[model samples]
Target: MGIEREIKLALPPEQADAADRFFSGIAGTPGRDVPLVNIYFDTPALALAGQKVALRLRKTPDGWLQTLKAAGSVQGGLHSRHEWETSVPGEALDFVALEHACDDAAALAALRAAASELGERFRTAFVRRLWQFEFDGARIEAAIDRGEVTAQVSGQTRREAISEIELELLRGEEPALHALTVRLSAAVAGLTPEDINKAQRGYRLCAQ
Candidate 1:
């Protein structure tokens, strides 16, 4: 288990090109675009969500990974959460591995109880443009994600656009994360701090 700290920002659709250019200029190279497909799971009653836990299987260029994120806190667009992630053999979820990785007793029990009933709730598909750099004695990964969140409910489909910047602290003082956001915010217009995460967005789509 690890504490995931990051700041999320909502980017207007129109500013995507400008954001790309800004990052490219700083990195001295174009950001790498990675297409990612993530399928979130939960029980019929959304028990996990009620517990503020989120589970998902993500397909990345490297391979499939299963992640379980427990509720943390979001303050001023900065999110701090407990995350457990592990690579799986294939598309299916490996609950055993997840249980082994989990250190929190309550979260582990919840995972065990929900394993049998878990099913796909919603999905997010997007291309993430990634850049890694150093700032103020800190290492950070900046991702510009563009795509949509989709869900099927009552024979109807719900969709929402995904255009956001995620600044994840790889290593360094937490304050540096905020400093970088301030720098980016000034250069990029229409950048608003976002407190809602993709999983939350997925759950909301399911409700509509």
Candidate 2:
């Protein structure tokens, strides 16, 4: 499951100007900030339990949108890289609005809380980071320009490093996987995930 969540905010007319100013230089470019909004959905009224395992979506000023995602330690259970972890793996708390950008914008500050308690209950978890690599003719890869994230999982296998480009599309986020897979396979013609057999973000796996 993904940890990042999106939310929309409806700030007061005065707050709008400040919010925009705050996020003016957030993410990559100016006025394009990607601050992780700090909104929490608490669980167990008696106990803080943990950061709500969800995000809060809301609307912002100038018709702009915002999102806040959950963040925390997700331990136990099966890590995708392995299938032998105990139980308990969850997200922290947050609100990330960038996910649903073009959706209806008339509504303001709508929220949805999860049915379970907060706190992480897993052994291992996945996080986000960026890395740079040069693809040699030894392998191949592809990318789909969809809103999906383009995080490439890479590792060193055997004699060469292998990299497999990956993206997360919604359960039914337009363009079926089958159809998209074909296009991706074609685009990644000769790549056999050999670029990154045991490497990711900036970590190395296996006995390298």
Candidate 3:
């Protein structure tokens, strides 16, 4: 199990260019752009969601990966969550591995039983740009994502725009993460803390 600490910031569409320029200096080398498709899974009754956890199958250039994220608190755009992920052959979930890695015995048992019933609930497809930086004695990964969260329900589809900046702490003190976000916020205008994640947004869209 891995603990993920990051901050998500909502950005205005028009501010994209300015945000890019602001980080150009701090980010020494930019990584190649990657397009990603993520499918969220859950039982029809949303058992996993009720447990405050989420399951996702992500398709990237490297390949497909299955990830299980445990419930974590989100406040003022700062999120701290526990996650477990492994490479998979396809979009199919490997329940055995996930259940084995889960620390919560009850949650794991429940997931094991519900695994067979899991189905795709929503999806997010986006183009993401990555940059890594060492700031204040901390390693951080800055991701700029632009895409849409699309959900199909009752033979209809709903879509929502996703334009945000995510600063993930690769290895560093938590305070450094906060400091970087504060600095970026000052440089870019109209940036606000985002409490809702992509999965949450997609689920809401599906519900609507």
Candidate 4:
């Protein structure tokens, strides 16, 4: 398991191009656009949600990956969470592999309890423009995600747009995330800190 430290910021859809230009100018190259399809799963009773745990299978250019994220705190858009991720052969989730990858006892127990009853609850499809660079002695990954979250409940479909910037500390002090966020916020107006993650949004959609 690894501690995923990142700062999430909400960006206005209209300002996406400007943000892209800003990152390109600073990084000295254009960002790479990666199309991603993410499906979130939970028990029908939402036991995982109640425990504040999130599980998802993501389809990337490289291959499929399953991730388990445990309950964590989000303060001022800075999210600190325990994450266990591993590559899978297909869209299906591998609970055995996930259990082995997970180091947190609570998270492991939660996965075991929910594994049998788990099913797809919602999905997020987005194109992530990624940029990696060294800033202030820190290796940071900046991503601009543009897409929407969708869920089907009671024979109806619900949707929400996802336009945000994520500044993650790949290897460095946490302060670097804030510094990069500050620079991006200043460069792109209307960028505000977002405390809610995509999983939370998916759960809320299911509730509605």
TM of each candidate vs. truth:
0.98, 0.21, 0.96, 0.98
Across 92-208, the per-residue lDDT of candidate 2 in tens digits comes to 223232224323221112223333553221111122122111222111111211111111123323222222233222233223323433443343333222222111211222122
Model 4: lDDT to the true structure = 0.94
Model 1 per-residue lDDT tens digits across residues 60-117: 9999999999989999899999999999989999988998998988788788888889
lDDT tens per residue, model 4, 139-197: 98889999999999999999999999999999989888888888888899999989999
Once superposed on the true structure, which residue ranges of model 1 sit more than 4 Å away at CA? none
* Model 3 clash tally, residue pairs: 0
- Order the candidate numbers by lDDT, best to worst: 4, 1, 3, 2
Cα lDDT, all candidates = 0.93, 0.25, 0.87, 0.94
**In model 4, what is the error at residue 22, expressed in angstroms?**
1.3
Clashing pairs in 3: none
Q: What stretches of model 4 exceed 4 Å from their correct place?
A: none
Q: Which candidate, 1 or 2, has the higher TM-score? A: 1
Decoy 4 TM-score against native: 0.98
